[model samples]
Structure formats: structure tokens, C-alpha cells
Target: MSTAETLDDVAAAARACRACTDLPLGPRPVLRVSATARLLIASQAPSTRVHVSGTPWTDASGVRLRTWLGMDEAAFYDGRRVAILPMGLCYPGRLPAGGDAPPRPGCAARWQPRLLPLMPAIRLTLLVGTYAQTHYLGRGAMTERVRDWRRHLPRFFPLPHPSWRTTGWEARNPWFGAEVLPALRAAVAAALAD
Candidate 1:
């Protein structure tokens, strides 16, 4: 099957998912990868706007995310080179602290194994938030805190989420933008070219 066909079929399966409906936020469709993807973008979950719009990365976070990766909108959305699968596909809603809640554990447990095996070409995976990092990076006492990005640098390239809320965090963590972003861009460019 063509890559788009593969992704669309996976998305369809995710749409019908009832696995995580028991959570406070009911299930919505999954956002996923094309079979031919060379890079994997493991983000958090859909923002409420993205869930409503039925498009992944259809918000300001997406804009900053693309910029961070040194990709334009068209390149960022190109499924063949970049697969945008969040830790959770649907919006999990907001916490009382005014932050978006973490992705439901159930979604990753149910989906990633099925989806990842399908993408043979994924060379570089960007773990773009705490949830994605924690899931992919595994539980280690040394790398548990998001602030300990130094511990997991280069290999998985853990990054803070590209949300407006991160502006303050970025200001505080100047080394992230100064050091990590250039390396991230180079990695993305090389992967896309390959």
C-alpha cells in the first residue's frame, strides 16, 4: 500500500478506538505516521483546537514546533518525511492548574507498537515533550525530571513543548535554544535528505 493509504487506514482504526473513552476526556481519532516516513515527531497530545479541527499541529504550538525544527509549514506537514504522532492523539483537556493535562497512558499502550513497526524509514525521532520523552526515553532515575535534559541529549533529543507557556521556560533555560535547537535542525535536515 502507499504510505498515505497506510496512514489513513491507521487513523481510521484510531478513530474507532474506544479503549480510552473511560478517561475524563472521551476518545477521539489518532494522528499518526505515513509508512514511508523518515522522521518521527513524538509530541504530547492534541490541543483542544487540533482535536476540534481534525488536524494535528493546527495551532501556535505547531508554528513554533515547525520553526524549532527548521521546517516550513509544507515540509512539516509532509507525511513522507515527518510522521506526527503525539503521545496521545486526542485532546485530554485542561488541568485545574491551567495547563493541558498529560496524555492518557492508555493511548500509547494501545497504539505505538502497532504504528511504529509500520514505519520502516524512521531514522530520527524527536521526543517533543515530557510525555513523549518519558515514554520513549524510558524510566531512569537520572533522566526523570524534564530539567535533566543534559542527561538525555543527542540520542533522543528531548525538548520542552513548543507552546506559548514555554516562553518563560525557554527564557530560564537559555541553553536549550542556544545548544539544542541547532543540533535538532541539523538532524532534521539530514534525515529529510536521506
Candidate 2:
């Protein structure tokens, strides 16, 4: 198969995936991947709005994430340049505090290994939220304290979940914006330029 054909096949399978029925709204994994992607953004999962919209990070999280990356909506949604594959594709119901739960384990079990191999040109992967960082980054993950992101800063670009709840956290961790985000922006700009 040609590269385009391969990408098409993968995308079709990604769309057809319904592997996580145990989770809240069933498995409607939101993934956008391409062979030409230079940046891979592996987030936790889509919010209820994102799942309904069939777009990854269509909510406030996406807005904050795009701001952090210094990318406008057009660049952020360009699949060829920005491959977005969340750890869990579906909305995993709501928590007691009324926030949505993490992505289902079944989604990751089904997609990750398959998708990573297809995106050869991915230079920088933005591992958003503790769940993604934990799954991708292993033992060094910041579990209880998402603010202690300093240890894993430069390597994989670890970040807190871009929710309204994290506004104070973002303010408290001045280093995240003042220090880490500049490097992330430069890295993103360089990768996109290349």
C-alpha cells in the first residue's frame, strides 16, 4: 500500500474503533494521526464536548493547549503537522465533583502501539495531564502532585491538564509559564518550520 493508503486505513480503523464499552459513553476515541506529523500530542482523553464534536480537545483544554503551543486553531487542527492521539479516546463518565473521568484503559490497550509506529516524523510529543504522562513516562510520573512537574520538564514536556480547575496551579507554578513554556514554544516552532 502507498503511504496515503496506509494513513487512510489507519484513520478508518481509528474511527471504527468501539473497544471501550465499559466506560461512560462507550468508546468513540478521538484520534487524528498522519504519516507527515512532526508533532505528536498524546493527551489523556476527550472531554464530553470534544467527544460529541468528533474533535480532540475542542473545549477549554484545547484552547489553553493551543495557547501554550503558540499555535492558532488552524495549525492546531492540521493533522499532517499535529497528530493528536489521546490515551483514552472516549469520555469516561463524570467524577463526583462533576468533572469528567479519565480515558478508559481499553482505548489505550487498543490503539497506542498501533498509532505510534505509523508516525515516524514525530519530533516532539506533548504529554498532557498526569494520566498521559504516567502511561508514557513511566515511574517518574507526577501522580498526586501535578505541580511537581519540574523533574520531568524538558524531556517530554509534561503539563497539567488545561482545565479551569488548574488556573490557580498555573499561577502558583510560575516556572511552568516563565520557564517551560518558552522552551516548548521554541521547540514547536522549530519542528513546524522543519
Candidate 3:
């Protein structure tokens, strides 16, 4: 496969990107993609663990996320089927109190517009966090956007971050597990069916 074309080119350029030159842990752009991917996991940013491993979603949050989608790791990480892009590719560092800082705004602003169009096969985009939700859906709280996920339909599906913080959120919003996950899983299966 002559991956040296669009997917590979953009991916390589994105990997080598030091756009946010002085990132706390340095510019290790952590994202995954394949030209043939039909499912796009448009997330927030890499965590320290994911950054160290050079793999997106190799953390606690990822585990919960996989469970939410009812997807096994093999299916979830299958590069040929799924593309994982975050609002920021690199780890933006942690806060003084705790938790990861927000992803650099510069990342999506600089790269997404150019990179996303290259993959026309993206049938389903799981916007998995406020950052992704805000960018794609625009001007809405994640709760409302996620609650009204039917409005977006087959193209875009909004989801909350699968971090521990969501434990409380999930407890409060029973519909997420009872309603959203089932629909999300079905959508994923349908998208990958071809």
C-alpha cells in the first residue's frame, strides 16, 4: 500500500509537528489513523500515559470508553477501521491541583481543517469530550449536546469523556448508559459493517 500519499503524508507531517513547541512533556504528537478508516474517534488530547506509549487511548479513560461502545480492544484499535484524532495531539501538561490541562487550541486550529478532509471514508465521528463536542457542534454544553445526540444522527455522535469524573455524571444521567451506549454500539457496528 503506497501510504506515502495523502493519509501518510498528513499523518507524518502531523506526527513531526511541534506546533505547540514548548508543551510540558514536549511535542510527542500522539494520534492514530488509516486512510481506510470509517470510524473517527475525535477526542480531546493525549494523556501522560498515552503520550509516553505513543498510542492514543491507552489509559483508564480508554478502558471505560471501550466498554461504553461495547467494543473489544482489537476492534477499537484496528487502524484500518478506526482513526483516532484529538483536538490536541500532544499532552498539554497537568494542572497545579490535578488532572490534565485542556488541549492546546492551536492543534485543531492548525491541523484539523487540513487533515480531516483527507479521510472521506469517515462515516461516523465520535466526538468524545467537551473539546471535540464544542468544536463540531458549537455553542452548547456537553450535557445538552450529548442528551440531544439524535439530532446529529449517523454522522456525529457526542460523548462525555470516559474519565473518572464521568462516574458522577453517569450516576446523575442514567440515560447515557441505558440509551446512548446501545445506540453508539449499533452505529459503530453499522459503520464498520462494510
For each of the candidates, the C-alpha root-mean-square deviation to the true structure, in angstroms, is 3.7, 3.0, 2.3
List candidate 2 stretches off by more than 4 Å: 1-5, 141-155
- Per-residue alpha-carbon lDDT of candidate 1 for residues 1-194, written as tens digits (9 for 90 to 100): 54544645666787788776565557776575788888888989988788878788999998888878888888888877778888887788888989898887778877787788778888778888778877987754322344465465444567778899888888887877887778778877777785
- What C-alpha lDDT, on a 0 to 100 scale, does residue 162 get in candidate 2? 86
Q: What's the TM for model 2?
A: 0.87
Instruction: Please give the distance, in angstroms, between residue 134's alpha carbon in candidate 3 and its true position after superposition.
Output: 1.0
The TM-score leader among the candidates is 3
| Tens-digit per-residue lDDT, 1-194, candidate 2 | 54443666776887887666576677676888989998888888788898799988889888998888888999999987989888887778898988877677667767787778878888878778878887887755453334454454444667777889778887877777887778778878877786
Model 1: number of backbone collisions? 0
Each prediction's total of clashing residue pairs, residues at least 3 apart in sequence or on different chains, is 0, 0, 0
Model 1: lDDT of residue 12: 75
2 against 3, candidate with superior lDDT:
3
- Which scores greater on TM-score, model 1 or model 2? 2
lDDT of 3 by residue, 27-130 (tens): 99988887789999999999989999999899999999999999999999999999999999999998899989999977888878777888889999999999
True-vs-predicted CA distance for residue 116, candidate 2, Å = 0.8
After aligning candidate 3 to the native by TM-score, how far in Å is the CA of 72 from where it should be? Answer: 0.8
Best by lDDT: 3
What C-alpha lDDT, on a 0 to 100 scale, does residue 186 get in candidate 1?
Answer: 83
What order do you get sorting by lDDT, best first? 3, 2, 1
